[model samples]
Target: MNVALIPFDTAAPSDGSGVRRALRRLPLRDVLQLAVVAKVEGTATLNDVSRELASERIGAELQRAGSPALRRRSLQILSVGCEGITTPGGWLIASLKAPAGRGFGLALGHARSAPVAMHDRATRKHIGSAATAVRAAMRRAGLDRKAVELVLIKSPIRLAGGGPHVGSTAASRGAAALGAALALGDIYESDLRDGSLCTDWRLHGFRAMAFSGTETDCCEALVMGNRRGGDPLLRVERAVLSDILDAAPLAALAAGAKAIFFKAGIGRSGAVRGARTTVLTSELPPDKQLRAAASGVVGAILGTTRAFISGGAEHQAPPGACLAAVIRAAD
Candidate 1:
């Protein structure tokens, strides 16, 4: 099976436009599922985004197009992170996975502060706090704990007017590691002591990344897995990359293969964002092929699934780090 990991930044008009445009340009014969992440400007919650999108006719459009509406699935794992900003004070990060076709749709959110401490180095603390909140949400939603796969955290440094800069690099990486550890249920107070969350690179499994110039102050998290049970409609396959540069060729090679799903992950190294990114692709677009690709990638990385590929490379993925794919699985 082949998968393509396409990245996109919903905050950017071009990125979002490109995706909408892609739908028009493509064959439109396959099943198409979408996942979107927008770094909102002020204090916004996951529900806020969901509500806004729902209110703005986006959900209606999907329904009209025969796509599924926003439905929250069971809680599996959780990841959180924080970043500093001038006007917003601080930003929060969280990712959650939801059922969509054969795979899941991973949603990432960024919330801006309402004048809280913005420069604190307590990124891991923020992530942990968010995780607790998510657990509460899960309980409210009636989701089980054992279904979670992993959690991811994306952290950025403080910047002027809440935009992207180099200051938040280390903080973002730390947040990622801490979030992953927490999602896997292995976090300790000592781990938070030296601010070792972002410093450590050995932590791998779940994927995480951070960027500057976001619009919101809330952190977002998404859970990815097969908790909804097996689907005779499709099957999924995943491949993890130790290096992002390796993802492109791998995806190209996998194109036109016999897999229903293909997904990848993107991460960073050191204080700077890594160059590699993840990808997911399918034999066709719009139907089971597209849905399977989205699900596979969501399950594979524990990140957002319906994102536009362009912004992902520019905003989510670092310079050279990227993930790509081709999907061809059994129906």
Candidate 2:
């Protein structure tokens, strides 16, 4: 089956009315499934926008204006900032900032030192702060140390010209590593001070990606679990990409003539610009065996392929390894 990626303006309405308008303008059938809807903003946080919609009762207005069938249909909301959004409808929405917002290590710099020193210093501070917060959060939540499946972090990037870049940084990366370790009870303050925080890739157990355009000044984190309690409708899966060449094989495996959605990214050590190919199949495969195989293969290929390789495995994945799939069980 063929899937198309259609871009829409999400900044106009908080309750998806903007998306609805865009959809109406499309030549496609009115009943077509919308895989994902994304919102772009120059200075807005996703959570803030969502909250604003609810707070301002914009959702009610949208509901009132929406077609009766649309109003009655079930809706699921997912959000991602600079990284982009993937929907169950086999669509991927990639959001990019203006040209001025692109650059490496844009958000991190030493108060008074060389770039390397500034990066190092920023890393230390971010890790320290995040680790503290994770520890406190875990203790308050009364969660078993191992039950925390992963500690994901979203931090701001330093852009060029005192602006913001659209990616991660040494500081944000360091914070992600430290926060994960701390959540798993794997690292101590002394360990962090001694430069053991993210110096070893073997201990990399969590996922962290920093996007620069977020409106929030403070960092944000989410603690995910593997248990079946809480929100049963939400399912999450995380997989590692062991090789870049594995992308094709993985895509084939993931597509399996089934409707599936995904997202992909390279690590800091990755090449100047990683090459990635994504496929969204329109039919659901028969079993998890094929689905898992497809997802794994694609990830492995993407991680190891020369076109998408990164050299920063010291604190991320292995030298050639990367992350690929996030499969959410159908509701």
Candidate 3:
């Protein structure tokens, strides 16, 4: 796999000029990914920079693109903005491409997060949209749902809620997972009732790693699978743990992965392994704590501080447990 990282200057203007400038940094044809991470410094807005690049498209080489550019087909962009004090207000767009091979296939798809009325009740619409996105991605890649071996589902959640938004974090993750499962036949529609989501631990989806947060408004999903014809240069391995402390599976599945993605549930009682914790007890927010703890544990093994570690573990794994998956150099 070939991945390139380009960091833009903070002084860059967010208007069309900014994107044009970024393009000047790299060749468009060789670039397959454009992930914009802008850290807000002072009063400057990274969101402004992200919004500036939103309308760009690639017409040809040297052509400035915002996103959804045509490269064999239209490309999807993941724009992430982090506001802070010292960080630069720019981006680190990566150039990612699969290893060269005739059999290699890939797919990308997304759907908005809307709460739909199902069974006379309001529920996260991610289920329906995720189903559509997953199906579309598989179809584009000429693969079946069964061929899908890994998935990453991200949804925006309300951090603080008074009534309806309570448990919004779990709600967002549950909906996304259920939607992905629908496409894979991991869970049946009969099991998706008004109370079935975020409740029934028995109704879990295999290979669907879900994360929910205040960063998004809709559900976004990325799916990767293997086809018999494709001798892929990338490999994905999965594991379902009985609990958070279960490291047996982690060692086996994450052997050679370049990256790892997993979900961990803050114990319902706000405790882990019988120790009282502050996920819901102290003044510290639970979400932040979840992120810290997740990265801490995964970092110890991967020997890198960076990985897709998040909370909202819900049905992603056993209750009070976790789900782990790795991406590695193909065997």
Candidate 4:
């Protein structure tokens, strides 16, 4: 994959209009010259990206840009990379994945689904729409159905009465997973129809990791897998979980990969291995809380605090369970 390293200074005036206007004025030749610099990138000062976005009422825009980049890019980092004592600036690094055994495969594709219905009902409609995006990514990566190993999808959530409705996110995630299952052949298309989403917990994509977010209007996915004669610089691996407490398999997978990602099912009873989880009892949304808890657990287990944990378990693995995976560099 080719990476473009543009040192963007995030310290711009309100609405970023000044920088936006300056960019518009750049001559075509100079802009083309800047395109030659590629590979890895570093940071620039983002004195107040958050404040600026808030002042402009473009939080959704910020969220939109961030979520899609994360969905499509193999590695997207926006970091200050320092302890809190004195750091005020940061970097924005976005890496694109290429096709045909060149680098890690990541595809940004979108799909639309019916919105407004409550819970699993809406997701039944999401099933068909989400499949389109999944296939698009698979095609871009030049991977046959069998070659695809992991699917990371952020499904679009539906707002009720123009506001947040409980379990709406779950609905979208269920639809997205069902869609992935169809594409990956984990479940036959004939096995699905109305009322098949969350109800049919038995149906799911063994390799798909799906989540629903309020930031997107459509489905976006990242497909990672093995390519024969692919670049040896990286490797992909996965493991299913018997329970949230089950860490043996994840540890084993970690032994073989350089970086790992985990997806844990929040049990219906709101507990991990029978000990109640605070996520269910707190006012915090389950998804957000799940992210923190799961990350903490996996990070502690692996002795690496930078773990990526997507929160959801609707048919992602066995009943009330989930999976773990790792991305390793070739030795």
- TM-score of every candidate relative to the true structure: 0.43, 0.44, 0.68, 0.65
After aligning candidate 4 to the native by TM-score, how far in Å is the CA of 228 from where it should be? 1.6
Looking at model 4, which ten-residue stretch has the lowest summed lDDT?
32-41
Better of 1 and 2 by lDDT: 2
Residues 1-331 of candidate 2: C-alpha lDDT, one tens digit per residue: 1122343434433545545554444334232222232322212332336434421332353345455453332122223322112111112211112233212110100011112222333356555555554454444323356655444343433332231212334434545455556556665555555445444444554343222222333344443333322223223344555643445434533421211222233333433236532222225211122223333543353331111111122344444444443323324
Q: Candidate 1: give its CA RMSD in angstroms.
A: 13.2
Full-model lDDT for every candidate: 0.31, 0.35, 0.54, 0.53
Rank candidates by TM-score, best first. Answer: 3, 4, 2, 1
lDDT tens digits, residue span 1-331, model 1: 1112222223321123433432343222332223333322222222224223322332343344433432121111111111121110111111223344343322222222222135542354545544553354333323344443322233333443352322453344345345444544545445455444443444433323322222223434432222343232222233433333343344543433322122222333211143322322323311122223334443334333332121122222223243332222333
Clashes of each: 85, 35, 5, 1
Tell me, by TM-score, which candidate is best.
3
Highest-lDDT candidate: 3
Predicted structure 1, TM vs. truth = 0.43
TM-score between model 4 and native: 0.65
**What is the Å distance of residue 12 in model 1 from its true position?**
7.1
* lDDT per residue as tens, model 3, 1-331: 2433344444422333444566666555665544343322221122234432332322232232533353333232222222211222333334345565565433323333343323211153557766665666556444587778776666554444343545455666777788788878887788787677766678777778765534355555556665644435555567776656667787776556665566666657887788887787887556546655766666665665445555567666656777887666666
**Clashing residue pairs in candidate 3 (N, C-alpha, C atoms within 3 angstroms):** 56-65, 56-66, 57-66, 113-218, 157-213
